[model samples]
Target: MCSRRRWGTSPRRGRARPICSTWRADWPGRAVPTSRNFSPWRHFLHELAGVQPDDPVPLDDVAELRAWKERFPTRLEALLGPLPSAVPPEVEVVSSEDCGRYRRDKIVFDVEHHLSSPAWLLVPHDRETPGAAVLAQHEHGLGRGKDEVCAVDGGDDGLREHIRTHRSDYGHQLAERGYVVLATDLRTFGERADWNPPHLYACDLTHVHAAMLGRNLLALDLWDLARALDVLCAHPLVDPARVGMVGLSVGGTVTLFLAAWDTRVKAAVVSGYFSSWASSAAVAWNMCGSQVLHGMLGRLEHVDLAAAIAPRPLLVESGTRDDLFPIDVARAEMAKLARVYDRLDAAAHLEHDVFDDGHRWNGERAYPFLDHWL
Candidate 1:
């Protein structure tokens, strides 16, 4: 059977059904969303919510697009906090393993002033040089870090099963396809989580600490991603000029923002996360702390941030039955962003795949899209 047609027929599909069937909850971390005084609180937030109606005028020229792009990033900085400046740390190899067509290296590097990050760099064997590369970010899955994407040994059976259900190994997939791939853990996962007290989920505690200091995790995550781009470009075989990023869930959240902030990401594929935040975050409340940007809606819509990468090849994947980002909303915002891309005379560069599946990596379209563009 075609794999796409078998999204629901995998051996563990029955066990994984509840992972998506239970809406308002995110898998791998944190609790299900709950607005205690549902109606009153929602209305209260609605009064304060401020996703402005995007400029209706199509950007007819590059100059107009440039103006549109310049208008919002400053406001975003105020909301997400400033993107940091850090010297690139030297890459250290911890281990390397041959994973069939690709060789995987377990490496570590400093992403911030004192923050070290664990990552897996997967490079294809007997491959051509000056080829494309992808910075693949994994889902915001609890305890899942670079290991999940690199198909590294997870030690725990449950963790391995979770990775299987999510198909969260696309970094390995991309590398085996001949693209150099770097999969990095974010702030709260893997060895970085060692600092927090043992009982706490790192994400929960990290959110609290970041907020206590009047900063947000989103800022740090973005800075780490930007720095990682520099490292990816430094790879000898990677075409520094041709790099892209693809992620699922929170990773998709990072993908859109990374592309927006850095032009070095020549192309992108954002899966399972780009929809009307007005509908999901505001109403359904299906968002996490790490993904939040205070007052983001006041200046820009999700589609607008996405369009900031306009005229570049972009493919957004949405599952028709995915509750996290409803298909109707995904299609609506996609149409809106398509118009923005159309302004640059690069409408063909913008596309969306409405998959007949749920929230996971739907690479049937994404892989080809990246290969075509990068």
Candidate 2:
């Protein structure tokens, strides 16, 4: 899921020499490189967009998207290193219950993680007709208490508390319609990345510490998602070829990245968070530390990430009143993507549903698209 390139303010569109034979940072002036075949211009392009590097890249065409995603799982493997090819010894399902209205059973399982991290996996009880699974991704911000991503009803007052107070409709709704739903937590959110009380570091200070490793929490969180996929594929009921992903806000951001980087994900729904970077940076007050890139303003835009999902079915749900991402910009960005998908001969698969709301998922419009596609 790539964003737009803010060309006017991006680093000069100059060619970059390889940072080094081994690492990108070793390169000379203006060159940003990494240990792998890092694309500094791509990096700089992200910076120009006012979105952070940890954000997913926008897709431009089916060919381009497929090419980038082909090796994503491999790259992730390199990062996490030889993940459990089989379920971890500590993996266990602790509980299961039927949510009467949705007609799907909610099951909670635990995976003992190496980082001393423990993850809870929630799955819908319904069985798939054939090959199908939906990765119900969660947003960031929760550090404990309750995870709202797993709740079916968001509850009164409608605050959208994630798993604790609501079941992510994106996940459970699809399960009722006959798809195995996989919902899990990302680092620093929900139970996986919870820090002890009196957090070692306050939320606002994450960026300063990220400088120590030349990385950010988003980068690390995404890595965890990639690993979760490994476990998802290992399940007997899961279909490796027909996996799809859906998320809102932060979850939507990761959905874009996961679809772009992981071939295993066949479709995606990027909700509430899809919008043009140019307009977003200019007006949205919600832009946070890692949300804006170091030098992306002049090169790519929000639509680019949508382009990356080319050839694959993608549905973007935008809230008309969303303060973080303008609806008009989202429509325009989606239009840019429509052309790219058309060029790839997969135009029929692209779709967008806009609603009158702010920053929250409409839920009603997105699931049917996933049903039709995956």
Candidate 3:
């Protein structure tokens, strides 16, 4: 037998009453309560706890490290889908100006047959010969893109404030220190942003579109950056052998992956984005589609991907108060990566600069690290 109780007031009593229900079987009576406090995200977190890599890459020795490096990037590239054929950048200088310690030139170059990237090339006045060059990447923001890193004047007050607060003008800083800096917009930003009717920040939309085509927005951007490297290396003022990269936030994501994939980047400074994938995934807005590797979660962690840059000079900057990436996880991940460097006998090549702040660039150690390595 089953009994039901209506919520609120009982019809016969015409007054408020407690609600209850019960069910009785052949043997006895029992009641089961329904819960209203469950969350799907909590279930997902539960599932994530059980997931682990099928074959975590071995870092036992130099042979294993070399073998892993040989095969991992190929696997990663395959996951990213096809890349556009390499072609001569066919660079064009659009304009130039004196900017205190460096001369900034506006240039455009082809990354694909139909696609081009706009950039600012900062060449220091004091350099007498070919010197180190750095690919300076910018974080996500309103329409400033490359301009933020190069510290171009006369943008909106918000942009100016962002630049000041984040210490984001590192490209300009690199120029002042005598390194040639190439600052460019990754797609769907600054001049590359969608300007049509019902315009929106297009990273999510663009990432969806690329995924439909079995491509990734990040892979596409990395290709563009590689071409940008070609342009930087070709510059008479730059020594191709002494190339490095520095970036904050989303820019740091690019710096980490690009330096890992392209050995041409002799040293790298990855700021504000080195925490584990699991940590980033815990926050919904932290992992963007553009930065996603399709099946990478169980197959690897951020440390595994970062280990590919082992034996190479890498400086990671983490802010103690960076709630997005979480400095605690960054420290743990860096410790894991340090083991890989230790195994490779390149322990000195790895450095972690933990500063007391939030998500932003801290060049105190980075500038010196790059100077010593590159």
Candidate 4:
């Protein structure tokens, strides 16, 4: 009355006729709620069809793995750019010679993306028909140089030092054992980079964005890896079916994901990064960096991702004293995966090499596994 507007009022009691009095008659019975109770099977099918699954789906089945892969093409584009084109580079062996008992070379290529993923290909001197090929993945801080790529003597200086001192550089030793070896640099690392901030793992977020062009920095690095594989498989002397990958630390992380995502990778030796998520949760330095994607935990655990490689040949190298990822948790996770592998009757395919040291790859244990599987 005070010249004020009245508040909008609800229908008096229950008596404002429905918006459409006849609308109720459109259905023969009281409206059935369109939403149904949650069904796990339906969710599984939806995820299988490229619709993201509800927060979690049963992780043990091959069907789920296939479905999760289906979701990637759609989701990856939003987070990472289109899959990098796979234009096999014009591989040319620029130089070749003997490095001790092994034959080594400086191999160059004009990769499609101009990524400059050069490598040193090594083979046992005068050996033919090697059992397999091992793509030696280098560690985080080092750029892949000849010394880093072929660290046969086990001395220090980036990856070369890590491999040489550890007696692993499986690239060098594996070649000596008649296994063809291809050791190359991931995108932002090694001789591949002509300027500053040499490695991706150590760079600032801004650097990642500037270099990778809206791609998840880690994903960009791994894509380079897949492209490298494209070249290796084409090698006339290499046994395409007997291919393996091995590395330490972040290299281990790549080893893990590469084996899971690419079935063509028949075997792998992952060191310095095998401990369980629960164990990794404690150590401050153990966490690789802020870039470890936030969504990995919300959806899949490392163990689950490891299990995704079940029935395939996988060798996890863990450090008993390593603070990065706890040893006990790693073993427990391995046991969980063993059950799945057992179901597939390929239980022998999964193995763990527990070393007495911390944060390093145990090369001795790893080499034999490659010899056996590849």
**Which residue runs of candidate 1 sit more than 4 Å off their true CA positions?**
1-40, 43-45, 48-64, 195-201, 283-285
Error of 2 at 15 (Å): 49
Report the Cα lDDT for residue 276, model 4: 51
Across 11-81, the per-residue lDDT of candidate 2 in tens digits comes to: 56564433223333422344543554476655645555654434243344456556654544454434322
Q: TM-scores across all candidates?
A: 0.83, 0.67, 0.87, 0.73
**Which of 2 and 4 is the better model by lDDT?**
4
Q: What lDDT tens digits, residue by residue, belong to model 3 across residues 166-276?
A: 999999999999999999998887778764225444777788888888788998988899999999988998999999999988899888889888889999999999998
lDDT of 1 by residue, 1-374 (tens): 21121113347454433322333333346564575455876675766574466453244566777776777666567777754558667889999889889888888888777677778888899766778999999887756677877777558788778778788888988987889999998888766565545655667677777888877888888888887888889989999888999988889999998898788999999988999667676544467666877666545667877888887889998988888888899998888788788777889999899878888878888888988898
Candidate 3 vs candidate 4: which has greater TM-score?
3
- Candidates' lDDT values, in order? 0.79, 0.60, 0.84, 0.66
TM-score-superior candidate, 1 or 4: 1
**With candidate 1 superimposed using the best TM-score fit, by how many Å does residue 22's alpha carbon deviate from the native?**
44
Model 4 TM-score is 0.73
Q: Cα RMSD (Å) between model 3 and the true structure?
A: 6.8
- Candidate 2 Cα errors over 4 Å, as ranges: 1-90, 98-113, 116-130, 140-146, 152-168, 193-204, 289-300
